[model samples]
Target: MTLSRAESAADHDRTVVVGAGLAGLAAALKLAEAGKAVTLLESRRQLGGRASSFLDPSTQELVDNCQHVSMGCCTNLADFCDRVGISDQIEIHRILYFLDEQGHVSRMSAAPLPAPLHLAPSFLFLRFLRLGQKIQVARGMIALLARSADTPGESFLAWLRAKGQQDDTIERFWGLVLTSALNESIDRIDLHYARQVFVEGFLARGRAFRVEIPRTPLSEFYGPVLEASLRSRGVDLRTQTNVARVVFENARVAGVSLRTGETISAKNVILAVAPHHVASLIPEENRRQDDRFEGIERLESSPITSVHLWYDRPVMTYPHLVVVGRQVQWLFRRPAGNEGYVQAVISASRDLSARGAEEVLSIVRAETEELLPLARSATLKHHRVVTERRATFSVLPGVDRDRPSSDSSTAGLVLAGDYVQTGWPATMEGAVRGGYIAAGSVLGLSPAQSLVPSLQAEPTVRLLAWLAEYIFPTRKGTLG
Candidate 1:
């Protein structure tokens, strides 16, 4: 599409955004809405980066890299979808199902009660955990609610043990939640992020725990809708465009150099690409001098594996299930129109990477049969394994210190990615928050000023949180 009159007027004042992931799309959308001349560059033909979908040759169906879900607390992501006019395509499910090895299913749904207690009734009746274990888990939740800050270099695993949680309680309750939410093991997850997930997602608001899943494939959800929105705002959206490096001239940002030996000149540039790509984009001398650049390189990524299975008939009765005490962490039924397809997700799947596809399938198939009785009789039509080696940055203890903010030392250069310090874990919400922060840096706004507000806590919930903090003030020391 041709540029609008307003875009033409501000063509000289260009802000170039690299990477077309959620971060880049959010940044570009904000700048375009602000009437800034924007150019969004995406290396791949698809728009949603890791969140995008692909066409499987074997099944000839659009498949998401992994099943991505958003909670009600993910306000920025919800806002982005609404802004892009794709909000109707996402369906919110309030009931969450958890299945154990013995095929017993436990449903967790919100009641009419207030925050922190709305889901307590269902949680207390979970069939997977014994009464004693449930009580122990409840104590852990209270401790998490009362905590003020995270201990540096401490993992959630250590925190749970210190809270008097045992193997059964930790694995069935804590692991089930943290593994799926953070996409990392409890031993490696930062306590701050773990607290954020529970406090915001579970304890803060009754609606916060409701999960939202896209009704369509991710590509259809983000690619076309986002591209149309950007283009309508007169953003120059370029796909299959590889950026060679950010051209820094005289200690300031110039623009980006394309791999085709072409350079796009701009005063402001946001390197919203992956962390590893940042070092090569800058000059060698700048990399040596900049501490943030060095820290970005030190950040490590965790893996997620999605196993797609198709059967002759429906194998799962529920839309999704949180599989406990197994390598398979979550199982999801494909959205409507695809009845027989089910996707199993294994977060922190480094061990599975070493296995062959058939072996992996065998193990997953066995687990599926055990969890869902219908799967045992259904015929396996097709199967595919998709493993994202660098799915998300590991939220390890003390790792947030290494996460770079939107502002770079170099003038006119900004950063945006899930790996950036967004206060949340590596999620769609965190990504959009980083993008907004980057745009704010370019538009002379504070991070808080640019981002959308989180879902508000009820008055009673807020008072309880305050009391917890006020009564038991946190001290600077590691827990046993």
Candidate 2:
């Protein structure tokens, strides 16, 4: 097609994607790549939404709301990074370091064993779990494997107790992993989605647990890069442009009205904001009638707390470490030097908000000193406490049924977000999946058309996957 004809074709497929979060960014990019004239709108001046950064006045550096990471299971997010030319800013960690309160360390990586057994070596050698506790944990895994993979009906806590999981095992092992992944306590997280994290991210693929840590501030990684790419590809991105309402005519989306009362006409629209923001944006006439839109209102939020600590000297040896037996869940070391900067993560940290920032920081500092000897003597240069009261949606039992699909009742309107029934938790992967699904919805394509293929198991791991199914017959459902 000629340049004019191509431009005309793009005009014919003009699409408006609201909220330049990961979902909106990915959807806009996918549509633009697919020959659509795409316009991305965000109410905020900066993009990346929850995964964004702010200029810290005290340190004069960009600060992320919290440290975010992608896993090998996040195929779509990886693809999005590669497409946006920012993949080099990400550093992948094939190993993880865990530290108990006593400062006992355990190095965890994929062992040479087959699929489900790849993590067996590290778990077996860990000093944290006694022999009896290990045995109990093994039994718990057996019980988890025996349970139904689909049709989640209860809390993961209930399932763990029924499996005879000890309180210590639950706290040190299952709770640590589950709380971090789901951003909610075991009592609130669904058994089905929790199982999906272990089975797909741990069992189905040996390397799926690898972490992708960003080397730069999230602000640099997302906003500037996306702006450049969108402009080059003729995609319009409007910052600080609040979409007031989804204008509909005859049960079809006519356009979107801005806060300034100007209406931008478009052939298609994708609602790509957080779940809480959905109800207000949709016309009252349509939301009350469609259960799918109303279901988003039923979803709730979970809080996360991150502590950024700057020390005058090196405190931690590893890039990151999981803290055992503490409210502080994980620690991430900023690159270049291990000494100067580090972050502490606490998922489902509503309780932390009740305590003042100084108290929280004091406790975190004490805990840090106990774990890393260097921290005791190191001069504390600076510290910042970041608490996102509603960092993500609480994945309560049966929330799977509550999420709406990308295609909506209004003919040209679609939905996209980490909360939009992506089968994955509210992570980078899920957001990217939602974006791809939304892009597909507007372009008359299936998810498979825009989404990267799911990562496959190694040859030996594939055999172990079959063995896993045979031993535990309940492994018969889709992995998100």
Candidate 3:
């Protein structure tokens, strides 16, 4: 039963992955690992897509388009970073704080305790919520965690009303959490999606508090790391390569035609690009039966805006702050050494985008100064505005059904993107998960079973540790 070299080489499968974002890179890596010849095509000169960063021409310093943060449950993304050899570049914060425009501050420490109990003190002390509101919020959390069945994929606002939560509480606390987690307003977000956010980020024991933030620009973090990793694994990464149309024959993908009039056949082709671009690349006939592919048309998008400022002096001491009752949702103090650079992330920014750059910058500056009074005395160095008009699919009511599945009807074609249905919102985690799922589907592997091993172990360990701390509360004078 001796096989010849030609016979052995002929057994290898070839896969083409379009787009070089997190989802695309993840699929490409998995395929390569499975002994498939993979080629990744990216229209942009650099990778990371929306998460990319650039060097400021004036200061010659690296700056990301916006700041991104991840929690402990972001195992898939962390694993991808580890595989790419840059996991250490991310810093994890066990404790997070919120600062309002009036200089009021509330801190949430990752102190070990029972599931929701660990967060109770922080919730009670939150200046944004009144005493009665805190109790209502606690009851809401209890109800959410105790529920056995999934909520209907309807408006989160309606769900809150059904839970007996008042509108004032939703406006103060629930709305902020929903907006930050889903990147959509509470009135529009699906209840199930909102529940998933709370369950995964807060209720899942230690999973809630392990906040990981990028130390370098995302483009530098992901672009080079992924490019080098893929190339080393023998993947043909074609930058500036545009796929004109996906050619299909007899309900199967025949090949892809390039913009320059070239063609390459593949055993499988994964369409890992954004939702809006899917219709143009796929054929009309193939898209007809493929509900997942066609579902992209039903999904709407939300916008995210960022205001970057370089100051003559450091304006804030903290690395990040969550602001309530303000246009700015989150703020980050970038690593500029002696120089001062700050970035403000405006999530679910609708009205902010309608204003001109000067107006937007002015509002952000005024808010920043109001929150950080010391910034008023500091000299303004430079400012820049970055807006992602379609940053993510709107996670509004009934929109969840529109999210595309990883599997498509076309035999040789799969889909991957944050907007694709990964049982999560349009986030880095969602994007990475979609890539993993798409890769598994193309390679004929059970994604759920493959993911189970990693998912189960850590959560169990964290849960036990949390339980131990709860049963035996530490005394103030106790020493090691």
Candidate 4:
């Protein structure tokens, strides 16, 4: 049954946001800024949900479960940082260095060219490919650019294969990009999302250049920053509270039932929770009664594991690097004072999750020694393992069909999550995009005009003309 008119207007003009993750906090901030009475509820005492951080008792320092990085195209997330006043707490890099299984290092940096052309040099110098392989990779990228953006295309792996990419090329280069960007293999990722990642990450000139990571823990980076900002704007943030169920009187949502049996009435309710939690909150009658959530069942999830090791000596020269041909996909060096801390992220991980913490740590140590020789002789002070079984929705074949719209069927009830059909993978970009879209829905505004500035580069044709000289590299092209 849906909610009655009386209940709908019980708290007219007020909006309640469930889930205190990025999506929920983003919606609350947006709605509150629009002069709407907003209340945010989080089940956990602390915010940031999966992005939350914990303090290490031994070191008395803060640490995040995983190391997350964002690129220049992630305008929504950057805007979020701006909104929360923590933009300065994030550091951005212009160059990305890759370390292959063979211990060969290649640096991908931006060129002087406009948007997409700026990436040509980095592509040419990539050590993972041979001279012929580099040409094939460029040709494949051009073909991808030529494809229609609106229609769903072939699997990324198939498209590469059709472009004559060898198995070795895919394993050495394409696999690393796909696995890190989508948290799934190339063969399994949806073409639409993969294309988006490439377009925003590589094709855009200055966009692909700026890679940002939080200098602090997720909570400090977002939780308190958002909470203070929202509260200052008069948003009500309820923590450690569970919404028993949403009350529907007629065909609309009336209010939410709290664990205390108290009902908080609100005209608009944004179900900013994950997809798996939606079925539990919505009324049984209103639900489709399917085993899996509709419009999202096609998406499956893969796991990611992060192993943290504290050492007496610094083990890495750079803050982060992508590892190829190893169990360790990415390694981040987080140094606090004299203590050296490192986090190794295993993306598209399955078997690693089943292993014990000690086993995971040992593998991470071995892998670290291979990449950074300094780490081999360092004394291990401490180790911790964090695993997110459903770290992100698998970007498998036909996954686009299962993506859900930001707007919900029920009035005043919207869905928000990285998995909610954002045309991006379940990365920070997707989560922030979903939040921005959902916030627009809550404020009855067009998503295109949200607070986040658009990062869409000019049409490829126009950009190409302006960047012709830089696009075609000569033998004399300077690496520096």
Q: All models: lDDT?
A: 0.86, 0.82, 0.77, 0.75
**Which digits, one per residue and each the tens of the lDDT, describe model 3 over residues 186-265?**
78887678767776677666555567888778887786766888899888899999988877767787567789887767
Q: What is the TM-score of each candidate against the true structure?
A: 0.96, 0.92, 0.90, 0.90
Q: Is candidate 1 or candidate 2 better by lDDT?
A: 1
lDDT tens digits, residues 19-55, model 2? 9999999999998888788899999998888999998
> Candidate 1, which segments miss by more than 4 Å at Cα?
1-11, 147-153, 469-473
What lDDT does candidate 2 reach at residue 391? 90
Flag regions of model 3 displaced more than 4 Å. 1-12, 336-338, 450-480
Q: Could you give candidate 1's per-residue lDDT for residues 222-243 as a string of tens digits? A: 9677788889998899999999
**Between 1 and 4, whose TM-score is larger?**
1
Model 4 Cα lDDT, one tens digit per residue, 98-194 = 8876878888888777656678878788876789877777765654554343235447776667557888878877787888778887678766777
Ranking the candidates on lDDT from highest down gives: 1, 2, 3, 4
Which residue pairs collide, candidate 2?
314-339
What is the C-alpha local distance difference test score of candidate 3? Answer: 0.77
Off by over 4 Å in 2: 1-12, 142-147, 458-480
- Better structure of 1 and 3 per lDDT: 1
- What lDDT score goes with residue 390 in model 4? 84
